[model samples]
Target: MDGVILNVVTWSDMYYLDTWGRRQFMILGAVVMSICMLIVGMLSRTEGRPAYDPTLYKVNFDFANIVSAGTAVLALRYLYVASFAIS
Candidate 1:
């Protein structure tokens, strides 16, 4: 690597880097990924969706179910965070 300072390297680095910043990134990424999955999952129901055809996006799942599950998991994580913050 060059002499330039990189932001982060390992998971432990995340621990000392910025707790809130890492949490925010994780939360945001999860949300965006979940949304994208939901959209693609819905499109799968239709015969043809231009953005992702069978040849492109090849994931199989019930969109609503996945969204519900993802939300629940993330929410639980955030709940723990909230609990910690309150205490």
Candidate 2:
């Protein structure tokens, strides 16, 4: 059972890295940004006092940047694998 699970996970990870990993990361970033924007907008719309902080935007941007960088690294690794396989 453990072996089977490990095999499945390995296959899934390979497939994701080769195919959809970068796209998925991009989608995740967009979703995170959208959610952050929505939260800030809602907070700003609240009565009297402003609840949104600039730090929140900075934090969200930093998180997305990290994800993008990681995704880029993975994509480069995938390209290297492809090149090695072709050679």
Off by over 4 Å in 1: 1-20, 49-87
Q: Can you write out model 1's per-residue Cα lDDT over 1-87, one digit (the tens) per residue?
A: 211112222433456437556566566556655665555445545433234347756654333534655455445444444323322
The most accurate candidate by TM-score is 1
TM-score of predicted model 1? 0.34
Give the per-residue lDDT of model 2 (tens digit) for 4-34. Answer: 5445545555656656655664565456545
* Residue 69 miss distance in model 1 (angstroms): 25
Where does model 2 exceed 4 Å of error?
1-20, 47-87
